[model samples]
Target: MSAAPELRRNSLDLPEAVEAARAQYAARRPRSAALHAGALEVLAGGNTRTVIAYEPFPAAMVRGEDCRLWDLDDHAYLDLCGEYTAGLFGHSEPRIHDALHAVLRRGINFASVGPGEEKLARLICGRFPSIERVRFTNSGTEANLMALTAARAFTGRAKIMAFRGGYHGGVLTFPITGASLATLPLPFVMADYNDNDSAAAVARANAADLAVILVEPMQGSGGCIPARPDFLATLRALADETGAVLIFDEVMTSRHSAGGVQARLGITPDMTTLGKYIAGGMSFGAFGGRADIMALFGGKLPHAGTFNNNVLSMAAGGVAMGEIFTAEVAEALYQRGEALRARLNAVGAAAGVPLSFTGIGSMLTAQFRIPAPDRPYVPTPGEEQLRELFFFDMLEAGIYLARRGMVALSLPVADADLDRFVAAVADFAENRAELLRADGVTG
Candidate 1:
């Protein structure tokens, strides 16, 4: 007997699936929709941060406690995004709260230099191996900008070497071809990330004019791809050979280890830019390195910001680094992240799907692809649709993550929460097995 009419392996149309998901998301977040509508009257596209904006609008989170976030519609989710790695301490950490409270009670801002700034600077210099004379900025963007300025001033060169897909803040993003429209116009030499020969060629081509070779130890926004150690070492050697300053954009990767990615890789960049959780969830950024280079601001070049040494950020950052994120604590967190990623990968393998996670330490990006032996690192075309579907699915499962499938583990994230997230991922893979299989995704 012939099999009753062959069944369709992938019956779901991607467009239709996306539409249905958007509709479901909208239906579940009426309050968020209303808020977005209200915000449109004031903010452009009803959003200020482009990264957080998504189709059919985004959720308006109301409050967060520990690793949980409550959105406008009162939906609670495990905050795996971790405020894009800014909330490493998570929301409402008792220590951070108490520290900020004390700051508020004593003073909010002081026009003059304060003891808090010096204390925080000392703490940072001690923790980060490369930093010797740290200077604070209001945001990572500011910190990166200042770092580049220092590099240019020191080298007396105008050209910079940056990698494609490396983000150095809002104004310093370099995509595949050129800098983003909003990025500051600079003489940039773009090179392929993690490609040693490409980077060396670029650096050598502009050696005379190369002021700084800026890079992230791990590309946080570029799918959380970590740079190969050999590649970083090559960049280091190139910087030395060309007399170009090397700047490590450790704003995101700093959370990975006590001494940051540079320390982990045993490659000391001339300068390191920091931000995110360094201020204990407050507004913060810092750039510092070799004493001679950082000394530019002392007399040679002027760097000033009204809030550069804001009392609250300095106090919170000092406590967070000195007390909360000690070496032992960071090591434990890194180990936990390693265990979680291994389990997540195992889940994908058992499902026989070409799903993989890329990242180092407490950060990861879940990627879906059609299996191709020759192009293993290449993502499948239109795989973003699958990622969007996964985002909606995970959100529905009470797990929240970056729409791009990025996750940053917070200190408050419990072992049970990680297990739950992995289980959720397994469910997604199994439930969508037919679609994945039809997409040529294989073991």
Candidate 2:
């Protein structure tokens, strides 16, 4: 799903260097340029998804193999973007790939329940601490919608308490940039992330009507900013006090551990929403927690979708959870990510740029901010320019990550390839030192 975020914006002008880089970007991707031009006739702005709409046009990739991708221009890339954390097993995982093929052999559109669905559901319920009884959805967006609906149905309330920069799904985004027109019309008590006092205040004010408090353990599109432990604890406490269903949006963060961030932090939520890498890269999402809360479905609060338990996704996701991404592999990949992030941060420091990598485990993002951020977004003047420049620079060196600087390391990404990524990052930090040190840029 290329799954580029509909995250950031552009209002201020970029530096001349960025303009030059953009030109270089156009020069290198002639085939992509023509494809995009042709595509514009049918697709909106050469994209159906909003996130793929980036400055200097997004590259048109033809195919991918284990940790690598080939673009329309024939440029090869080390895929650090990891399909926005959805490609955890990499492009060609034998087990997951085999599962999909096997499903096709069995045929599709089975009108009744399939064996694969029950097996996959058991695996998911076993893995997540919050999910005692689970239900499937086609995407994370759908899972999050159902989660909120369940919360409302269970609590008989109307409002949602979420963070300023939280992103539950396409329709559930509440960016620090501003209100998105596509956001769901559900009442929101938006609170600042990592600010326990303020978040507590807002939660209490809406406690009477707040049915759910949905949040990401890390703000994936909001620059991978993690929620402070105490901030989450405060929310947990507030939910207990207010009778709200605390929903952890682990769509991206679920890849962090075998049980996810809730296990990492040792804080359990009343409900959990999951997607991204969970389905072995097939379109998948699940919502579940506490058996009593999930009983909404049994009470016949309808949750329907034909593909909710499609054998392809269920089979592939079962392979992903039960076979490929086991507890040991999850731990090792996490260590690899920590080491990589540390090295990247060291490179930025040595080059004297206010750049750092943020997020936990194999999923992280490159952030151009001072002293790092505990909040959702700070929105400094030149932050967007720096992010764009860094993106083009990475592309020129054949390392592909999200334009917003998000990186989600996949299981197949080799250590040597990681070393090369670090070297490329060091090169970028060295080359962009002056621009980064410029007063308004990193401030």
Strongest candidate by TM-score: 2
TM-scores of the candidates in the order shown: 0.95, 0.95
- Model 1 pairs whose backbones collide: none
* Segments in model 2 whose C-alpha atoms lie over 4 Å from true places: 1-14, 439-443
Q: Flag regions of model 1 displaced more than 4 Å.
A: 1-10, 370-381, 440-443
CA lDDT, candidate 1, residue 70 = 94
User: Candidate 1 at residue 209, lDDT?
Assistant: 95
> Candidate 2, overall lDDT?
0.86
Can you write out model 1's per-residue Cα lDDT over 79-174, one digit (the tens) per residue?
999989999999988988898899899877669999889999999899888898999999999999999999999999999999888888888887
Residues 249-351, model 2: lDDT tens digits: 9999988889999988999999999998888999999999999999989975998898999888889988899888999999899899889888888888788
User: What Cα-based lDDT does every candidate model obtain?
Assistant: 0.85, 0.86
Candidate 2 residue pairs that clash: none
